[model samples]
Target: MTRQRYHHGDLRRALLSAAAEAIAESGVNSLSMRDLARRAGVSHAAPGHHFADKAGLLTALATDGFQQLAKALGTSRLASNSLLELGVTYLRFALAHRGTFEVMFRTDLYHAADPDLLAARQRAADALYAGMADLPDAPAVASEEVREVALAAWSMVHGFATLWLSGAFPDSAAEDPVEAARVILGRVFTLHAGVIPSPEAS
Candidate 1:
């Protein structure tokens, strides 16, 4: 039987959603406009009307990923364990949207300077900074100091997520990535927060 053609009112949304699924299942390198068109049941040329090229499509996906990440980070609260909670949320977002997360950081795959991508990225960054500033014991620090801490925290969480996704952990301790991430991230940030962590605990 012939596949039903895409005749929806919002082809843009449909194409984006399809592209996301395609990337998640096949990785960013395998995503293509033609494949997305077929996935969405639209003519191969239909994607062109919405996205000029694959770069445009991936740029849009990256923009969407950052916006969603900002929301995830924004709503994450600091119960007594501030860094652990915030870092967990960051890891969750990456693991949940593995495809978009992969494309969002690979500057070589997408237009890194796209205006929408920049705005979304800024919001995500701002959310992290705000999360750091809200820590209970966090002092009345300079913005620069807060910025430095935020960058470090982001690096640590991003590194953990990237490494976990790459299966870089060993079984003796990494039998569970989530638990391992929580312990590893909590310990590392606890140290950064001026608490002397016992290496054995880590």
Candidate 2:
């Protein structure tokens, strides 16, 4: 049977929507353009119009992920915001878009050299780096230390999200991943001028 486009006439959106659902159901490595077309109720060749190939579709998804992540990181940001908030927000974004979040970092799955992808990636990185100002003892405009702390913060949240989504934490040990993430991040990082009990004390 032949498939047809959505009545709203947004084939690209429809295909991307289907791809996201498919990725969530399976994974990026398992996503197929033909499968996406079928899910979107479009003809087999319909997805080809907006994307050249599977790489093209994945590239689009990765790009979208980065742009949205940047926005997420930028939301209600302030010098008063703690590393805990930033890290929590990062985890939230990851949990919300598990599939795109997965593909955004795994360059092996998509075209890492794509110009748009590179720009969007940088935007997301910049957003993450924005959290540097929250470091308690970092010097003002400390570019090197900011970069280091930013890397540490990113690593902390990234690692926590990866593990939580993998079901590494058992329900008996810790049921709420977000709270667990907050508690863990709270111990490791703090905001400027904000005081919290040391991890050892908690």
Candidate 3:
């Protein structure tokens, strides 16, 4: 008997979800279109209907990953609290969604030139920086100062997460990497002000 195909609403999302899982389990290099379709409980052609190929699927995943990450980072209401919170959230998301996180940042795996994907990635970064505006005395800092601070913070958290995920950290390090990231980021950003311009007196 011929197997029935899925036609339910939101098949695209379902496929992406399945694809993320597959990537997480075996890495992007091992993921295949047929594998995704199998995991999604759909016919092989169904994935093609939504995403023409593996590259297309990866592009969509990257776009979706950025949008979701932006939302996660922006969930904190207080702007003053956003920077640290966003960094924590970023590390948490990466640790939890390793597959999606890896593909989202690897431009070579996806069609990064796609306008929608590029825009989504930009929006993610913009949201992160916007949170910085909530700083108590940010405007007084020069543009370069802000960039320098932001890059430094990004580097610290990004490096920590990468090292933890890559198994470069000591086993004795706390298993909860997110907590470690928060503590480290807090210490780093707090002292970072001294490195930047002091706000002018009111």
Candidate 4:
């Protein structure tokens, strides 16, 4: 591969972009720092300069993914003001950022204890919990109850996205993932509504 020079700050970004593309095309197990440097048109040691090793690169990628997810959820919440819409947005992000999505949750692939990664993950969690708080009919529940509801909502969307990505769904569902998700989420929300106590009861 021809070695191309990148401006000081650009090298890190370029290598990260290449890593995401590589992981998306051939899963994380097949990814290598040498291949990433080659893909980025840089010296073999270039990626190492920015990321000490493959784990470091993945940690950076996962951190970015969580940050992006948090922003997407926050924007959806502000714009639509609906937990249902937030779920849809979450699915959309998972579909659109397949490479990052694949790595973000796999703790073994990255440095799970990295401060930046932890902070980013927390931001995403906070955003999801905030969405639960905004539900129109949702009453003022205890923190534990709120956490449980948030987890349920997160599980629903994350499970659906993971299954869809792995081709677990039929062709018909794949053809219109957004609509498919809307239908599934609607049912989940409907069932969920029965469990949450009314404001008067709360």
Q: Against the true structure, what is each candidate's TM-score?
A: 0.86, 0.84, 0.84, 0.89
Query: Which pairs clash in the backbone of model 2?
Result: none
- Report, for every candidate in turn, its global Cα lDDT versus the true structure: 0.79, 0.77, 0.76, 0.85
Model 1: CA > 4 A from native? 1-8, 78-81, 137-142, 172-174, 197-202
Best by TM-score: 4
Worst 10 residues of 1 by lDDT: 1-10
Root-mean-square deviation (CA) per prediction: 3.6, 3.7, 4.8, 4.1
Could you tell me the TM-score of candidate 1?
Answer: 0.86
State the lDDT at 28 in candidate 1.
80
Model 2, span 57-172: residue lDDT tens: 88999999899988888873554355677788889888888888878888887899999999998998888787566544432455667887778778978999988877786772
Candidate rank order under lDDT = 4, 1, 2, 3
Per-residue lDDT of candidate 1, residues 57-123 (tens digit): 8888899999999988888853443667788899989888888888888889889988889999999
| Model 4 residue 166 lDDT score | 89
Model 4, 22-73: lDDT tens digits are: 9889999999999998898888987877899999999999999999999999
lDDT of 3 at 170: 85
Question: Which scores higher on TM-score, 1 or 2?
Answer: 1
